[model samples]
Target: MSNQEKFVVSRIIPAPSHIECVSGGMFKLADGCPITVISPLAEAELSATLHDTCNVYWKATPSFSFQAGGEGIAADGYRLRVTAEHCEITASGLSGIRNAFKTMRQLAESERGVLKSTCWLLPPVAVEDEPALAFRGIHLCWFPETPTWEIEKNIRLAAYYKFNYAVIESWGMIRLESHPEYCWDEFAVDKKEVSRLVKLAASLGLTLIPQLNLFGHATSSRCGSGKQMLLDRHPEYASLFEPDGWTWCIANPCARQYLTELVTELHDLFDKPPFFHIGCDEAYNAGSCSLCRENYPAKLKAHLMYFYSLFAKRGARVMMWHDMLLNRDDPRWEGYTAYGHSSRGLDELYKELPKDIIICDWQYGYPEKDGKEPDWRTSHFFKQTGFDVLVCPWLERRGIKSLGCLAKQEKLFGILETTWHWYRGSFRKETLFVIASNAAWHPDWTPESNVVYREYLNRHLREMDQDMKSKKYIQFGSVQYQINPAPYQD
Candidate 1:
């Protein structure tokens, strides 16, 4: 065995200095501190080894050293060597350590490595890094009853790709009746489990943002005997109903109280950041209720003002969808807080909301945009708008390929990829949720570039042939094109 092979390598370390008898080196572990030391070459190889874990590590040779950093194939470990002046972690070295480092810097400014095993080298001095956008992130897991492997995988890839924020839309965490764990009509949320998910996301250098629905899409509230359904109890607060059976409501005292309680609980759960997305879109029947019809404009204005006061008191920056205020013909979307669309209302929305409030324009999978189309058409317009925008996409097969192409575009702020199990089935089937997630994180990463993601998905499908499948599977017998829209979707 070589001299470098004699010692049991607990983990790689950065370059070390030997003044007296004691040697100082860096190692891999969470928190702050070093524990052991291996060979000088082992320290250099730490960046290469970092691929096996999501945590950060330090690399050290003799003359040069660097924190394991970079993204894409380059960051995976094309070049890893330690030096006196710099710890070189190349683009192709150690599973994109460059990308990882850039992402880490966005989440937390820390000098510490994974563990305190030994004195480790710092990242290479010559390395250069930057993000594709400002709002890169992964969709927070909504179904608490379901396994979080998909979302966990999402954070892992988000870190790999360089996304900085994570937005969660969990029904289970909100103590709602629709969640599977409800017992005897009681509502509850698993706070510890939710915390575990948040910590994991944070460790990956992804900011955690909770998404709370304030209006419309309250199916969760109607689950238990329709008792908690604001629409059922306070019919006056319910949104208008369309002839086509679409339901809507307003911010009456009853609805406001319910929403307040929910927001307060959520605030207690996640107290890190002051920014919250008060979902107020998709109000199908905003003018149907008698009260809403009598005072439509006033109610709308008061709704926003009321929440602005409450959210401001909590020290939170606010974000919301601009759909309710968008005037298709008019240039203005009407003054509103942060607004979002399905990659459709960029031009008008940017003109309406405060510049500081972010815009989340989603494009699920629509690859092309002709004239007057909602998705691609709108995205083309947003390219020229001076506001920050986030592109949201889905995790299905079609969504994966389409979004990979979108992520390659440089003008957009960042992508918000989602692993949705809504309107169809459980999310357990999308086994490669993490792979698609990389599209948002890595500008260079594409659906075609994700061999790991493809292989995992193939395994989950049991290697079927041309037909839909032997039995029922994710891809089915054949492949079909999925649609992409706006900067938001499941």
Candidate 2:
């Protein structure tokens, strides 16, 4: 094959920032050949990942070398060079080295099918890569119906794509030891499972941030589902939430104490991450209770500040949704999803909120005018108000790209791609994950064809299955079943 063809064969997702062909023939890896890693950083995880993904063993001697530092290498950046007989990786830290090996794993797997005499042929190439946004993250929701294996798969895939953080929101899926009624009986995940997942994510260089719906989503269930996870089991606890169970009755001191305990337990279960997500979205009934209505926004502001102090005491900053901070009737946010109502004084909370709390502004649609890029006014508003902002996008490709581009251009904190309920189905193979990853890694990435991206995704999943030693069909595929069961007749 021509040199350009060989280079194209080694392409990987979230494509590296810089890559070029090198003067060398194809690098060959025989079936029994042992790869070697030379580096100051810990090599166990890197070695294991390479073996799992590329089916190559590692030795102590030669072939692969990792240099400690390199010019222009960022904390999470790496430079990789692959020649006919050897590979060299240069990075500044463990994260950079991990990222470099991740890239190399993909490159080797890309040419796994081009084997001759049981030897894989990889193209000679050089790559210098780093994420465009510092905080490349994905927000995953674990529901009662979601399987533990599925959650594990999502976490592994996010790390595989080089996402640095994963915000895990459990919708009544975590079995809180202190408050057993908070989760469903049969589906609740125990502490052991939670710890396993957390350690798995950490081992893969991915941070798992814990999330609890402190204000809204008090039922721990979607509003439309007509289910209240806690109240449905313990009717006596109804007084802690709004009459409809849509939001916590923050005015109640007992309710505050309950939430505090829950937060403390869940936070500790997650190993007390650097950031805690206090879901403060869709609280349409936030101050509807008589006691809460007495002072309205003052009480609301105090409620938020209470948790801010709670988490701060634990050495963690808070993250909350931005819907309630922006006025819904404002002309500037006419087409956006702003839930703040001026009549209730919720529209001005932004002015009083602490600057350290990261505002997660979720814009799920293409809000830009025709032929123009999105202005991301909401994110800019938060930043202008002196608060760090994380632009959140869900499922929409245009919105993901637009918000990601805005985050990069404005130098905002980063992008958090939310995959609510969609992560459980065929959407796993959809372009959303790849697109979001690429958007966070390289905002200016050229969109690849869906077919081509799908191939990359499939190969990644296959490699993951191999690493996991999965035996069942449900372990790795677009869908768990070939056909959908008839409604109520499984």
lDDT of each: 0.44, 0.80
Candidate 2 error regions (>4 Å): 1-10, 30-68, 110-120, 425-429, 448-451, 487-490
Tell me the tens digit of each residue's lDDT in model 1 across 156-218: 444544556767776533453232232121233456766776776665556678777665545
- Using TM-score as the measure, the top candidate is 2
Error of 1 at 195 (Å): 2.7
* Clash numbers, per candidate: 89, 0
Evaluate model 2: give its lDDT: 0.80
RMSD of 2: 3.1
Off by over 4 Å in 1: 1-130, 144-162, 176-187, 221-248, 325-352, 367-375, 380-387, 395-410, 422-438, 444-453, 456-490
What are the clashing pairs of model 2?
Answer: none
Q: RMSD for all candidates, in order, please.
A: 13.0, 3.1
